[model samples]
Structure formats: C-alpha cells, structure tokens
Target: MTAHYKNIVVHLPNWLGDTMLALPFLHGLRSVFPDARITAAGRLWVSDILHHFPPLDAVASISSTSGLINYLRGEKFDLGFLLPNSFRTALAFKLGRVPERAGYALDMRGILLTHPLKLTDAIMRESMVEYYMRLLEPFADISEIPRIMKLYPDEADRAEARRVFLENGWDGSSKLVGVNPFAFQWDTKRWLPERFAEVADRLAERYGVRCVFSSVEKDRPLMEKIKGMCRRPIIDLVGKVPLKILPAFMEHLSLFITNDSGLMHVAAAADIPIVAVFGSTDWQRTAPWSQKATLIRRQQDHEPCMKPTCSRDFRCMNDISVDEVFNAAEKYL
Candidate 1:
C-alpha cells in the first residue's frame, strides 16, 4: 500500500559548496520529520559530498525540462521545501500538485509557493551556509539554529583512501596539505596561481608538509601553473584520484587553501583548517565555516561582491598579496 505523507521533496542548491553548508538545516529538517519520507531533488553532478551523507533518504537528479519536472511530479511528495529561489523549483511542486509548498519569496516566485515567507529589509549576512540556514529554519527563531558543518567518512572510504595512498607510496605519517587553484564559476574568486604556488612551496619546504593539489580535468592547466611557480614539489591529483577518494583525501589533509569553491567547503566540513582566498565574494557572507578557518579578503575595495563576474580588473583578489596568504597559512602551521 502507498504510505501516507511517506514522500517529501527537498530542492537542493545548485552549487556543491552551498549544499554542504546547509548540513545544519538538513539535520534540523530530518529531526523534525523522522517519519516523513525525504527526497533531495537536485542535479547529480553537484552531489559528490551530499551522497556520502547518511541522513538523506534519496536525491533526484533532474535538469532537463521533461525528465526533471516529470520525475519531481512523479515522486508524489506530500509537501515540498524549495531551497532554491528559482521559479522553476517552486513551479515543479505546483505542477506536481503537491499538497504543501514552502520557500523564500524571490524571483517573483511568491505566488508559486503556498507558504511564502514575507521578506524584510535585505540585511547583509555571513557565509552562503548561514543564508541557507536562515531560509530553512524560518518562522521559528533563526538564532536558535546551530551552525554545524561536519562530514562522516566511513571505514571503507578511509580504507580506500589509505589503499590509494599506499599504492602511491603514502604512509599516513606525512602532513597533508590541500591546495586548490581553480575557481571555475567566477574569475574574481581566483587568486593568482603563482601566488598560491609560492605559499604552497613555503608550507612544504619550511614546514616539511606534503602538498596536494585538487582540480577538475579541465582545470589541469592551472595545476601546471602552480607546479611551475612552487620551488617544492607537489602531488597533482587533479585527474588522478577518483571522486570517491576526494573526501578521504580531504580528511587526510591537515590544512586546505583555495579559492571559493566546493573543495574548500568539503575540507571545512572534514574539519580540516581551511584558508580561502576571497576576491569578488564577501568573506563575511561566504567565508570557509568558522573561526578555525582563516579567510584572506580585500575589504578595502569591492567589499561585498554580489556580482558573478568581475568588473574591477580583478582588483579584489589582486590586492591580496602572497604574504597575506602565507601569513594566514602559517597560523595553522
């Protein structure tokens, strides 16, 4: 027999980084409704970290017009929480004929959402995760929501990481440092590759820490840039390590330094000290996670960059010198 209120839809954010940041909210939702079925609806490519999470009952990867909408409608969710502010996400529930729908009132999507929360003056905030949490724990007190971001890597994942490292001649004794140089989404988010390389080299030579670089297949060219700039050698695992190994690799690292990207957030969730180089994005709004993280940003110019593209000649990131990054990394050292 079909269950009653047995299915629910959770529309996730498009970005990988934001999804991990919403851990607290996700947990809150799960806590509130243990009986109701929870189905996370979003793209599959962005679910590298989320899939590892045990709390989520299921994730629906829907992107195409026919398949995406059809799958969402077919789920038969009793209620739906549209985390994404896009009209399409809200519209899906309406089309699905779901009994209840709730979301933030944005992009003229208020009418689509049955439970549209009223918006006050747009006050600035810190971090994308916090923004997500606020939207999640609405109606009740916002401050009560705990800002917790954590990742649980199982024995198999850790074992796999160890096996990969062992086959490649790693004994788990070497201090692991993660370096991410590519910011695919925005140019302004990318600090100079040479600058990042310099700091990575310093960390390796001065502290005897092993450097590990993370990048996408296309961003492999940036790895070359970092390799050329650094005096000390680094392990370039851009296309080498499989996706499953990413979490364990990140967990193995003592520190992670990168631009505003998903890998940075993963490192933070793994509880590894992270140093994020911020330019166009606001450090306050999207800094790593907590005080344990060191955020290097240029507040002097382009304070809170809501722009997806840069118009300031990369002034925001350019102002952040190699010295600043190295100094921040040194704190964790």
Candidate 2:
C-alpha cells in the first residue's frame, strides 16, 4: 500500500548546486501527493532562492537546529524528508516529533529515521540528480525521474536584470556571454582567470558578442582582475546581482562559461548553453544536468584528487587550455 502524506516538510541541502539537483525529487513528491502541502526548510539563501518555487507551499529559513526543531513541532508535520546528510539535521527531525522521517542511512542517522535507505556504491556513482531521486523510490516509480530543472523568477527579478543590462549598455540585440571565474571556496576547481579573459576576448572578437561577468561581493576583486586582463571591455555585474535575480539575468545570456560551481547549475536551470570546466571534482557526479552543456575536463592519468585545495600547481585545472574552452563555446555560438 502506498502511504499518503498530508503535511510534508523537506530539509533541503545547504549548497546551491545540490539544492538545484534536488528539483526532480521535489517534482516527484508533488506528483505523488498533489493535495499535500509541501514545505521547504533550509538556510536563508536556500529559502530565498526557492521562494515562490512551484513545488513548495512554504519556504522556511532555519538558523539553528534547535530553532528548526521548534518550528517543526509547531507545524506538526506528518512526514519529513531529510535531504542533507548531516547528523544534526536528522536529530532535529527526530526530536521535533515528526510522525515519519525518510532519508539515506549515511551520517549514522539511520537509527533516527522511520524510513532509512542504504547508500550503496552504485547510487554513490550516480549523478546528483539521480542521487536525490533515489529518495523517492519507496513512494514513486524511479525508472523515469524528471530530468528537467526549473526556477521561477518574478517580475522584480526580471526588472533588476533589465536594469543591469541597460546600465551596461547592452544593445538588446547583440549576444551576451556570461563568464564566471570563481568557484565558491574551492580553489582547485577554478581555472586560470587569465585564460578566462582570453576566451572571453576571443569569443567577443569572433562572434561580435558582449561578455558579462558576475560573482559574489567577496569575488569582486577576482572578477575585476579577469576584466582587466581582457583586451576588450567586459561588463562586470559582480556583487550587483542577487541569487534570486540570477536566473532572470542569465536568460539574457547566449552562452555561459564557468567552473564546477553553483552558477554552473544555475545556468543549467536557466536552460542556457554552457561551457563548464571541471577539475578536482567528479564531472560524472556533479556536471551540469543540461543537454545544452558542453563539459571541458582534462582526462587525468590518475583519479580525480577531489581536494578542496590543491598543492600540486592545480594541474587538473591548468591542463585545460584556453583554446579548448573557446572551441567548446564555439559549438553553442
């Protein structure tokens, strides 16, 4: 018998890319329980990004485990899905007295869950989209998990995007290419900024397109460095655009060149053509889940180092040349 849920609360992942990859799982949950009220609970940025998203009825920003437990108790949710693998989140759900809790058995939290699935090696090898989809197997058919990832950008977001374009002197007809040079905190994942500048310049020279760069406030200096290296002027939107407005802003882009970072997944959600560079991370597991994306990763003789920071001169990223990335971008142009 298929169990029916009335009030469901899902604890979303912390990282942006992981949250985006979980969209297919959210869709499956909605399909199985069309009448149920689904709530998404996560960090503030996660809540902001998911605000007004179709699958969720409410978005809660959690500050602490104790606070989350208190909120969960007040909601009296019948079912809770723990998407994050942290033991702390699982404990919160268990203590909050949710009637049912479902999640993978990793992080030693299996004892806390009402429904715990084992984390097999094969599932570990699967892509992140498929990894999240596994959580729906006991409730829904797993053979055909939805592959399409979507985001809703409101009118305000569109307006902000338009304002930035106009301020940057975009003619509205010329193609705009987005270049993202920084990868969150992972130094090993980022390719050379000078190479990025070269690719941006070449793409503009060849296609007569305009290159626009964006990142968080902390990465502004690096974005400026790349902009300075480019012979042709590039529009720098770093620190000016918010996470909620990125999807709307990305819609104006013809092509996105980025490292294996959150913006790479954002570009995928925007359904834009992408040239994603990967190093130190397994491309098979975290590559952009878009048919329009072309991945450029040097085939390392050894396994992926999978380190947050590299000491060996970052050969994995350095091995990929500027010409390689530009050629990949050409396919989409």
Candidate 3:
C-alpha cells in the first residue's frame, strides 16, 4: 500500500504546560492539512488534556519507543512533527520511515529530521507558545496567532464539572476562585504556601468568593499544610480530578491563582482569568498565554536562567507578597 501523505503523526511535548502551548501549532496544522488524518502521540497524562481537541483525529499514548515505531511502520505515517527535542523522538520517526519529518535541530537529532529547523538564540527567548508556533511556519502560512490558549471540554465534561460544583456545595451566585499552591518539578518556582494561604483567605473573606485548592496527588502534603494555615473555608480538590477532566473542573472557576505550573496553563486554556505567580522562571518564556492573566513576579538581580534549583537566596519568589497576588485577583473577583 502506497502512502498518499494522508496519515500524519505529531509527537507531542511531554510536559503538561508545553503540551498546552502546542495547541496553536496543532490548530495551524489542521488548517494546513484539512483532509489529512492527524494523530497526536504522547504520554497518557499529557495527551489526556487534549481529549476534546478538535484538530486531532485520535490521541495515542506512546508507552515504549520501539512499540511506537513498530506501530507507525504498519500505519505508514507520511509526515511527522517531532515537537519534543529528544533524540529518541527523532529516531522514532526516522526508524518508523515517516518520509517527511520536521523539528528543531536540537539534541544532535538534526541528521534524523528531513526538515531540521535551526532556531536562533533570540527566538528561543520568546514565549513557549510562540516558540512552538514557529515550528508550523514550514508547513503552513501562519499570519496571526491567538494569544488566548483554548480547550474544548464537551457537554459531558461540562456536566461533570457542574456535578462536582454542586457536590461541593458551591453556590452559583458566589464566584469561584482556584488556588494552586504547588509548582511541580521546580523548587525555585514555588512561592511560600503561607502566602498562598493568606491570598486564599483574602479571596474568601474580602472578595466573597469560594476558594478551591487544586493539586496533584504528590502535592497533597503541601496542600494540607496550606489548608491548615488558612482561616477561611477552602474546598480541597487535590488528587481527586483526573487530567482529562481538569479542563471541565476549571470551567467552574471564575478566576485561577497559581504558581507557574502546568495547571496555570490549563486554567488559561479553559479561558478563566488567572493570576500566575512567577519566581525564578522567566515569565517571558512560560507565563500563562491569556490576555486576562495577571503575572505577579518580583524582579531578580540577574536575568532569569533555566536553573531548576535556586543557587542564590530564593528572593525572587520570597519577595512576591500575598498582597500583590490578592490585588491582582481583585480585578476579576
């Protein structure tokens, strides 16, 4: 059977935030290849967020590299977009015999890609969304891009969100404010939980909004500590909501206040107003891509670097007070 450039595979970014940032690229790809069948392959947790993504005909979780390549060999994908810079990703496409593959020439994988793009240092400094969007330039004519991150939670997802809201006894009259206190995988990016507690307290007491704390199962201990510190009522949804259902859950929120974590991007994709607190991470590179977002970050002595752990006195995050976040939240609440 000869391939007709109909089956296309996109190797999605692994991180949740990066995955969310890739939506615009996927949208552009769909526009460019309207008749082509697009399959997004990634970890189950990462691609689960795109359960309602319209551009994708299917979402397949890649559990093993060899398994993926073997599967692709049979399917005969004509073109591939290797979004992840890992050499393994390019190798998979190369071995799978995807005739046309395009990606950044990083991780020494340029030889594997048929269309390897060399991004300049200046281009690397742009927002992750823009960086991802640039990848589609070779495949499509992208004139204008939408800044607002978008997610499509179906009617069933919306119904589930409403059910959870009712079960939590959330009053429809009162605005819902989401507080995510943990920043996964980076210690320097996390602001003090006490600060988040204070901000959640103020949102409830002063703004008259119902505050909900959202976090993954691993961050439960931190969530508990923040919950203990708070004086006002806070509904704990930690570890309960699945990633696929999170967009629906976020739909109930009027505003989301969070550390520069994956959920921050999720909130933005859900189109809820966000107050994202940045610490050591450069807001320019990874801030929530939403016009309604208010970024609260203290100025650093030096330009932000990609150091996961802070070498300096963690003043960048420590200096961002509860008042600043509360003030930002006031705009939406």
**lDDT (CA) for every model shown?**
0.75, 0.88, 0.85
Arrange candidates by TM-score, highest first: which order? 2, 3, 1
Candidate RMSDs in Å, in order, are: 3.0, 1.3, 2.2
Say what the RMSD of model 1 is.
Answer: 3.0
Local accuracy of candidate 2 as per-residue lDDT tens digits, 1-333: 344688999999998889988887888888777889999999987677887688889999999899999999999999999999989989999899998899999888999998898999898889999998888777878786566688888888888898988887787788899999889898888999999999999998999999999888999788767777999978888888888888899898999999999889988999999999999999989998898999988877664888888877777888899989999999998
Off by more than 4 A, model 2: 1-3
Better of 1 and 2 by lDDT: 2
Lowest summed lDDT across 10 adjacent residues in model 1 is found at 118-127
lDDT-based ranking = 2, 3, 1
Candidate 2 TM-score, true structure as reference: 0.97
How well is each residue in 94-127 modelled by candidate 1, as lDDT tens digits? 8877777888889899988877865544534545
Q: Where's the lowest-lDDT run of ten residues in candidate 3?
A: 139-148
Model 3 lDDT vs. the true structure?
0.85
Candidate 2 vs 3: which has more lDDT: 2
